[model samples]
Target: MPWQHKIAYLIGKPVGISLSNGQGTSGILCDVSNGKLLVLEYLYQSQFALKQYDFHMIQDINGFPPCMSQRLY
Candidate 1:
């Protein structure tokens, strides 16, 4: 799927992201920049942090229900 379509569908939603490096994380999809970066707000060390991932490094993206996201915070 195209980035724009995926971005629009996932923005403001909780999602699980799998990266090419074999690492994964779940976070709220915050924004996209230059159509090549994804900004995700996630919990780290008991605090919420924003992280940016390169589009090409993402292997997959899955949406999680809002209820699941609530449990994180």
Candidate 2:
């Protein structure tokens, strides 16, 4: 699939991500689009050096929206 399409699918779902370059740290998909992602509570070992992963999709989790809503003041 094209990169854009792949991003589209991840927009509203929880996904597992593994950074390809940096310490191979894995993060949960907090937000995603055709070009970027927001990982939440992410942590990796102390050896990886890359900043971003190569985009790997693990099994999708149930419950909770991929993106959370914020209250306006």
Candidate 3:
């Protein structure tokens, strides 16, 4: 499977998203796709809401897009 799809499997896991723009958003990895990510109860730029973000637009999946690392995203 592709790494993008691997991110989809992270549903229900907590993850911190770091964007290429130097912004970060943290929330439960509710859903993922080749094009986007759905986050629930997310905290970004001091804002709170449920929003879907583009995958390519993100710099990193804070805890690791797959959460396989010792330090979870």
Top candidate on lDDT is 1
Question: Candidate 2, which segments miss by more than 4 Å at Cα?
Answer: 22-28, 33-35, 42-73
Query: Which stretches in model 3 have alpha-carbon errors above 4 Å?
Result: 1-6, 42-48, 64-73
lDDT of 2 by residue, 1-73 (tens): 4443554555445454434343323334456544455555434565433232224542222223456577677
Residue pairs with backbone atoms closer than 3 Å in model 1 (clashes): none
What would the per-residue lDDT of candidate 3 be over residues 1-73, giving only the tens digit for each residue? Answer: 4446457556788777778789887888777655789888645587767788987777767444453557656
Candidate with better TM-score, 2 vs 3: 3
lDDT, candidates in the order shown: 0.75, 0.43, 0.72
- By lDDT, highest first, what's the ranking? 1, 3, 2
Q: How many angstroms is residue 26 displaced in model 1 relative to the true structure, after the best TM-score fit?
A: 0.6
The number of the candidate with the highest TM-score is 1
lDDT value for model 3: 0.72
